[model samples]
Target: VQPVLEDLDPALEEAAQSLGGSDWTIFTKVILPLLTPALLAGLSLSFARSLGEFGAIIFIAGNQPMSTEITALLIFIRLEEYDYQAAAAIASVLLLAAFTMLAVTNWLQSRALRYTVKG
Candidate 1:
């Protein structure tokens, strides 16, 4: 994210300001549009990371059966109980969800790129 922000041309903001744009306007019209790809990338990576944060969540939230159950923990519990079919099904669902999220991210990134300034 730092690299992405650094890569953006400072002159773009200066130009916007010279054109009588306010700080908010320069950010929204110039900076924000240029940072779209970085924002989307960060969002996607964080989402994927969050999905796999089973250990942290388990330690912090504790496995409270139905009350505070997470899919990953549920899959592990099913496996421990020798329910291979249930564990496999739950794992499959998680994989599908992750793939779906990636697909949507890619689509949005492509659309955003179309509006980005091409050098």
Candidate 2:
């Protein structure tokens, strides 16, 4: 988010202003599109982090085996029970989910910025 914000081309707004764009027009037409990728990336990363945070969640929602189980907690339980297959499956699902989110985030970002040349 910081990099995107810091590296944003001031010329975008300047050009809009020179062309008689209003403040709302410049922000909605120029700045918003540039910031979309950053916002999506942040959301994807935050969700991934929260998904893997089993320890913090465990304290809040006791370690009941069946309900309210986060993927990490479920994997831990399966491991303790020596259910290697189940543990592996659960871990794979979690990994796949995180990977999908990150991949989609990157793809969306690139697609959104496709017309932009590096400044």
Candidate 3:
């Protein structure tokens, strides 16, 4: 994210300033618009990572077999019990849901890029 913003041409902001645009205007009109793709990609990846976060959650929420736990943790519990069929079923469902969300986010990101003026 830092690299993406840093790599933008400083000349663009200078040009906007030369045209009487203020800092806010330069950011909203020039910088923010161009950062859309990176922002969306970041959000998409973060969401995907969050969906797979069993380890972190496990520290907070101790394992209780067949009881309340996130899907990822449940899948792990099933595996520990040698229940491959249950784990596989759970994993397949999770994958389908995650894939649907990612697909939608990517589609929206592509659509947004269509209206953006890229360099």
Per-candidate TM equals: 0.89, 0.77, 0.71
lDDT of 2 by residue, 2-85 (tens): 998899888888999999999999888888888888898789979978986988889999887778788888888889999999
lDDT of each: 0.87, 0.86, 0.84
Per-residue lDDT value at 36 in model 3: 79
Best first by TM-score, ranked: 1, 2, 3
Q: Which candidate gets the maximum TM-score versus the true structure?
A: 1
Off by over 4 Å in 1: none
Model 1 per-residue lDDT tens digits across residues 33-113? 778888889999899888777888888898797888888889889999999999999999999999998898899888888
Per-residue lDDT value at 83 in model 2: 100
Cα deviation of 118 in candidate 2 (Å)? 3.3
- Clashes (N, CA, C under 3 Å) per candidate: 0, 0, 0
Model 3: residues >4 Å from true position, as ranges? Answer: 64-68, 78-93, 115-119
lDDT over C-alpha atoms for residue 48 of model 1: 80
TM-score of 1: 0.89
CA displacement after TM-score superposition, residue 14 of candidate 2 (Å) = 4.3
After superposition on all C-alphas, the RMSD of every candidate to the true structure, in Å, is 1.4, 2.4, 3.1
lDDT of 1 at 96: 95
Clashing pairs in 2: none
